[model samples]
Target: MDEVAAAIADPVRRHILTMLRDESLSAGDIATRFAISRPAVSRHLRVLRESGLVRDELVGRKRIYRLDPGPLAPLAEWLAGLAGGDRWERRLDALETEIYRTRRERRARGPVEHRREHTA
Candidate 1:
């Protein structure tokens, strides 16, 4: 998971992944999409391949790159867990309701009456 996160941390690599999401592309095809040199894009692809976010196959003379998506499962599960429940929100709402009720009760009681002592 750490390797996957590190691989996806780059905006350029993320964009590369987006490009490969629907279709596979050759290394040259991916390089053409960016302003960077082919070597730079190749380095990014290497990192992605090592991290398991992408897979490449040799087709004829060209190597085609495609999104694997399997390594991202752990990241997706973790994110889903974070967004899974409203229990925290419900607890906060209950606390807020209790605070408001206490304030309302105090206000309804008005001011406190004081006993005055009479001295001879």
Candidate 2:
């Protein structure tokens, strides 16, 4: 997970992953899309490949890269918990505590009788 996080920390690598998400592209194809040098793109690809975020195959003389999202599951799940589940749980627990405190305060205050004043 740490490897995947580190690999995606660079905007270049993230863009590469986004590109590969749709279709596989050869190393040359990817490099051409970026303003950076081919060697720089190759290094980013190597980091992604090592992290298992992408898989590559040598077809003929060209190396093709594709997104492999399986390894991202753990990271995605962790992010999901942070964004949704755990946050909601904390909010609901806070709400419940507030509700209990309000109820206790109301009980302590006792019921009040309504009184009307007539215009003189």
Candidate 3:
């Protein structure tokens, strides 16, 4: 999971994954889409491959890459858990504010003092 997270952390690798999402592309095809050198794109592909986010096939003299998306399942679930926890945290925060407001209002209104009549 750590490897998959780290792999997707880079913008280049994310873009590569997006590119491969639709269709498999040869290494040269992917490299051409970026302004970086072919070796740099190759390195990004290597990271994705090592993280199991992508699969590569050797066809003739070219290596074609495609998205695997299997390793992303755990990461997606973990993120969903965080989102749920965040919603609960927001609710708790609102409840705390309401409790404090109610206490302050009660304190302000508590025990009205009686006025003494002065008969002179």
TM-score list, all predictions? 0.69, 0.71, 0.71
Worst-scoring 10-residue span by lDDT in model 3: 111-120
Tally clashes: model 1: 0
Q: Which whole-number lDDT from 0 to 100 does residue 87 have in model 3?
A: 83
Our tally of clashes for model 3 stands at: 0
RMSD to native, candidate 1 = 7.6
List per-prediction Cα lDDT, in the order shown.
Answer: 0.92, 0.91, 0.92
The C-alpha RMSD of each candidate to the native structure, in angstroms, is: 7.6, 6.7, 7.7
62: Cα error in model 3, Å? 0.5
The list of candidate 1 runs beyond 4 A from truth reads 85-120
Summarize candidate 2's per-residue lDDT along 1-120 as a digit string, tens digits.
899888889999999999999999999999999999999999999999999999999999999999999989999998897779888899999999999998887777665511221222
Q: What digit string (tens of lDDT, one per residue) describes model 1 on residues 49-90?
A: 999999999999999999999999999888768896576778
Q: Relative to the unseen true structure, what is the C-alpha lDDT of residue 70 in candidate 1, on a scale of 0 to 100?
A: 98
In model 2, what lDDT does residue 15 have?
Answer: 97
Model 3 spans with C-alpha error above 4 angstroms:
85-120
